[model samples]
Target: MAPKEEATNAKNVATQHSQEEQLLHQLPKPNIQNSKYTKRAVLKTLLNRDDGGFALVGERVVVGGWVKSSKETRVPIFRSFLKLFGVGGGGNGGKDSPLSFGQRVQQQPVFSTVTLQVSDGSCVASLQVIVDSTLAPPGRIMPSGTCILVEGVIQQATTSGKHTIELKAEKVLHLGVVEDHEKYPLSKKRLPLHTLRNWAHFRPRTTTVASMARIRHELTHGTHTFFQNNGFLYVQVPIITTTDSDEFSNKFQVTTLLSNKATEEETSTKASGVSLESIKASLKEKINRIEELKRTDSNREALLAAVQDHKKTNELALELEAEEKREKAKANALIKPDRLNFLDDFFSCQAFLTVSGRLHLESYACALGNVYSFGPRFKASTSQSTRHVSEMWTVEAEMAFAELEEAMNCATDLLKHLCKWVMQHCHEDMKFVLKRVDQNIALRLQSVQSTEFEKISYYKAIDVLKQVKDKNFTTNVEWGVPLTEEHESYLADEVYKKPVIIYDHPKEVKPFYVRQNDDGKTVAAFDVIVPKVGAVIRGSQNEERIKMLNIRIEEQGLSKDQYEWYLDLRRYGTAKHAGFSLNFDLVVLMATGISDIRDVIPFQRSFGKINN
Candidate 1:
């Protein structure tokens, strides 16, 4: 063991270590974030590792991806800078170079194929071309949501380690003119989820968004098949309804009266023997009282003095009148249907986008034995972050003759089935998206296929979260608080690192229909959470006894008449039924590791923006 021989061996070891790191980066990192992680950046990061490995930066090479950066000069005149060198200005014969893709095109052409010839002069010539849709034509195209095809040879630059090739445009074919581009406000760029909210139409084109949407679609089908195979009947729940089943005091009112135009008298005038003349008299008296107040205000010395001093009181009044008239005109623009009043005219039958399909699904579950409701649900909650949304898809399943444990088992099996099915179908998209999806698709499918998810009550979950190290949480875990995202994330990501079913939430936190456990303080509720995504699935064993359901309704202080049909489900033939809800958006986020709820759904419909 000579010193010289030992030094040589150490140097060889270091070299080999660097080579291994390069290979690791080149191979896909599964279950990682989907966007903002470019291959080159990942490769560079891996190569620059300081972990005393073989420095293999120069050995490995990246082949291709869409050009994230173009090498265009910042000089006011790019041609002039090139001319300073030995090269001629534009073309070999002094012809002008073609305009870059950023230039706006009047109309995108419509054709079967577009050929882009990336020759020696432009940036496209020195890079791999990604042919995608655009808003306009190829030449001088501003790259607005435009679609195109690319064909070119893969070339490399010897001096720099990075890949540099020319994309020769063989043809530029415009598909069609975007008549209302603003209406379809999507662009060909990577935007933050918050910014993408403004461009709902185009957001789905991004790799993360496209992948999430596809995953969600696959999960939806998986859910339906899982229930169908399990002998559960698929139920179509009613969207427009008079029933306030949960009686949460959040149901949007469905009335025929014009909310703005209908007078208070018209709304409350259900007199036993009152005449129309009496109603008119009461309305006139109220108007007169308002007029009297207005005159009194006008006569006030302070108001009169201020108006006189300002000398714009009359003008201000006139302006106010005009503004009020304009508002009224806008309000009255739409004519009310003969059968419908103003409120109903403005919005058809205050029938809301449902929050969940469980209530209506219960009716079918009672009649059909086992039933599940799967559809888009709307919620008006203002909480906005990585998790919550104003509108989302929910899966609510009801089972007759099923208990809480049975419900929990159903949820676990359904989740495993969904994960398995998605991995089997979405392999290509998974490879295309690369890392950032935070999933080892094969491993997840394999693990879920063989393993049963852990079932723990809410109290157990709280204990698990308490023991989790370095877990940052906003809300303290008490006996009855709803599980916060931090608690859920920690439980799923750190403690379990697998699917964890949390059941028996407090009745105070759960909705009215949730069956009361023997402890009275808790309800038979469950939520299936996994690593990276919080609250992917939620469900409850429903209170089916008419007396108990009515007591729940009374305890929640809801009007019984509003939910008579819901009661009828229990009255006719009630059974011990249990169900669970699957947050399809969360499923997509969990499946793809997409952080934003907006990007998870195609044609996102949520607060601030609703894309048609």
Candidate 2:
């Protein structure tokens, strides 16, 4: 009764199996190989080769990675011996006859094996590895953050439902055991970004920090490539300089006058009553003695001696007074000092960690036609905002014979190129960032890469802000008032939904180097404001006329002597040039949608925050 029906069912099952086999054959095969740097194979290459790494199922390879998770399993002596000696088994050791070194160790009352999930940080995925407990102690390699390098054969997973490929280790080549798992910061599965900041040295082992590092590398590579391809020479600018590029009085002073020895010496000197007041009192006493000698009809030679002493003492008093005035003048000029004489410092004058490289880049641009400087910059800002950092990397570029418009165009092109470059080259990291950090990061980057940045005058921007009906800006938008970050965010995020360049800012609000417009009230300056992160790029047409430069420098109360070298470029063959600086960290924040600027940098240097 069932012969014909059973035959039909058997035929149907066979057809289904054949179709599944055809689908498997159609899938792409992975081409896996060992790394050139080491004999060990890269986990990324293995995992990304084919789906589940099935293509290299039977290959023997060495791998090195940090342990993500580990579990130990114990089996009965009878089953352990049977599996170890390949007695009536079909698994990895089923074909062995004589007991090997690993097998001999496993022939105990209870044999233990450790299963580990390991990652090398080359990608988000981790590989499964099984190791004999005797080869590598379970207590040593079981905790998270333990690093191990092992030689193993890739096999199909037998227990882990998620991982299709697992490594069966024959030997433990190396072990970087964690001293204590409970005290480790990254032992927990999830930690807040702020918490990770405290452990920056170990944070890179985490997925988020690793992904950020990769993205940062790609962006840096892209930066150099873009500049090199565009005929712009890379110029290394001085990190220490006498001139304040931004004229903002926010530069960190680079001085040796505050050293411990100097401080102790100064403290002792101050405590010894050797100040100007003491000199003045001594001068008065000497003058009074001379007067007494003159009035008492003393000997002519003695009176002459007293008058000579009085003159010498009076001269000392004047010299000390002048020194105090000079010190006060230096402080008023924004060359901040703790009343320490800069003339006695290492440089013999005031010096500072450069806040921007644009001024220096201009000197190179004048000669090289186009030039750029990329390096660390410092600002002595006391701001504790999420956007402010005491130390950061910046990309500043200057173009010769280019005005504000040309500079703006170059900045736009550079931004678009960087966005496109990272999207293409750092696709995996960007995807990880999108998944873990922000969901709309990819879309935001694509929009920036494709859309043309809108250009509007500062007056126009102010008008647009005034007309906005939905949001209340904290800063009161006005004609001469500087645009706050909130104002910039509104323009770029709410009004334009992309980058917006606001140009022709008020002259009072811009730096002295910015060229004044014909209206005499505003300067030919522009800032490229991006969504989420306010202004990322700030550019301006430089003041080239010598007379105007002097006037502007004087108007801003800056020391003209400090910028005379910069002014010489204008005095001697100054062509109309413009330049801008791009905040590299902010660009990262924009691309990754990371809210804090501290997360992007490796070792954050913020207000009251520094670590090795």
Candidate 3:
């Protein structure tokens, strides 16, 4: 080598050696004595800090849960919700753009990160931090969701009037490792909630679900304290029940029979062809007679009308002929009609799951003088929306000798108490969640506490809705029409822009148990709508007089047999009572500012997704 070249190489080597020595000196010094701050306490302290930006953007935040997902095929988290949370598509002016759909679509919030850690104990030792392959260093399996300590900074994020903040990790310290790692259903690539139904066990590891669950916990605690302090008894209602409280057909039939027994019953019924015979008998009796009546009608004026009537009559006659033929064929086959012996049925008796606890609490109100039932309610309605759930926890309270006015006052006080307690006790949890999921949750709760809810009658709300020119809703919401979600949301989120209580609904739309007002047009029912949660509380004053209750049951054409006990409540000790069923999830959804209901419930039983 040339003299000059050799001299330069030696100089560079010395410089490199000095740099290595400096790096060694800068290595982090571990604290020898481990402090005793529990995970809970540390989390609280992190949240209690008013400078949330420090922990999220500067100070490291090490969140360790479980392996919710891995880097295998999982794309960047941003890719999953880009269209929903992204920028740049705004006013691009495409004629067919989503913005032109008359409603502004919510954009999914974006987050940026540097490191993600996944680990197992033996092969992958503790303290291994994974880096992004494209941008930074090669990724490593430190541990996914496994408990780790990380150092990071917190920063505020804002876009499109919405605000959020998150922790940006500098260095991650992987503590211990967990084995037998299970693949969490929530992956970096977003999947529809229905797809994640089977893996509800791991949904909480997802940021959205975790935030929701925490909010749910906080709301539940708030509700308990709200009633406990308000002199309302916290009554635990039964789960497996026989009474159809809601009187809605959306009840799941409880059956204890094994699959084999069901098969046997099916086979026996098929062999006898009893279902076919029953259909044949009904068809034979009704079709021809109705057809003859239509043919004999004298109101027909036009030849076209006469021909149309003849066509209908012939079709019915043919249907009756077919039914008779079927009956004869069944008799020739020597198969007797099958009888449904309820006693012999392997499934035995079927009972309904409680739809709403309000009625049961009403019963208690009559017996115990004043009572409340707070428990989980089951609904079989298949509505796959942002706010519907099959199984939900509810707080239903009944007050004896209370009128509609008194009921409204109680609901307001209860709500205020709930908001106060959640703000007080759940400050830390709420703070942590706000940092992780929603930034405006505290502000929402603060508003609830600070502002007095506006109260309006149902008729006034309709007048407000009628003024809205957007979408021209065809449901024709007059003073007596049922309140659709759109109208309710507009009242709470748009017009009032706060929690609202809408009362005095038309009796035709309300249930029979509701007390009819002196006007004889509307019932004493009220629905409380929170800003974002929509309809959160539904309640009404009960018809206390036994004679009135019985008349209502008959007027509504409800089977008096199914309501013996409900009637007994009035016959024994009737009082002018009022009650409300507070949808607990909705409370949390509002308190936490969560946009979706699926996030609030752990292992949620949503529509079109049944667990095996």
Q: In terms of lDDT, which candidate is strongest?
A: 2
**Regions of model 2 farther than 4 Å from truth:** 1-34, 50-52, 83-108, 159-164, 260-338
Question: Could you tell which candidate, 1 or 3, scores higher by lDDT?
Answer: 3
Cα TM-score of candidate 1: 0.60
How does candidate 3 fare on TM-score? 0.61
Cα miss at 453, model 3 (Å)? 1.9
Worst 10 residues of 2 by lDDT: 260-269
User: What tens-digit string does per-residue lDDT give for candidate 1 at 492-543?
Assistant: 7777777778888889888888888888789888888777777877778888
| C-alpha TM-scores of all predictions | 0.60, 0.80, 0.61
Ranking by lDDT: 2, 3, 1
lDDT of 2 by residue, 1-612 (tens): 499999999999899768855765765545567788887898888876547687677678899999988899987566666666666454355335333434655556776899999999888789999998779878899999999999988877877487878999999999999998889999998898888999989989988888888888889999999999999999999999888777764878877765633344343335766798888788878878887887897899999898888888788778777766765554445433767688888999988898888888889988889999899999988888888799999999999999998999999999999999989988778878888899998888889899989999999999998898888888888888889899998889888898899999999988888999889999999999989888999999998888998999899888988887898898788899998999999998888888999998899998888887
Looking at candidate 2, what is the lDDT of residue 504?
97
Q: Select the stronger candidate by TM-score from 1 and 2.
A: 2
Q: CA lDDT, every prediction? A: 0.60, 0.86, 0.64
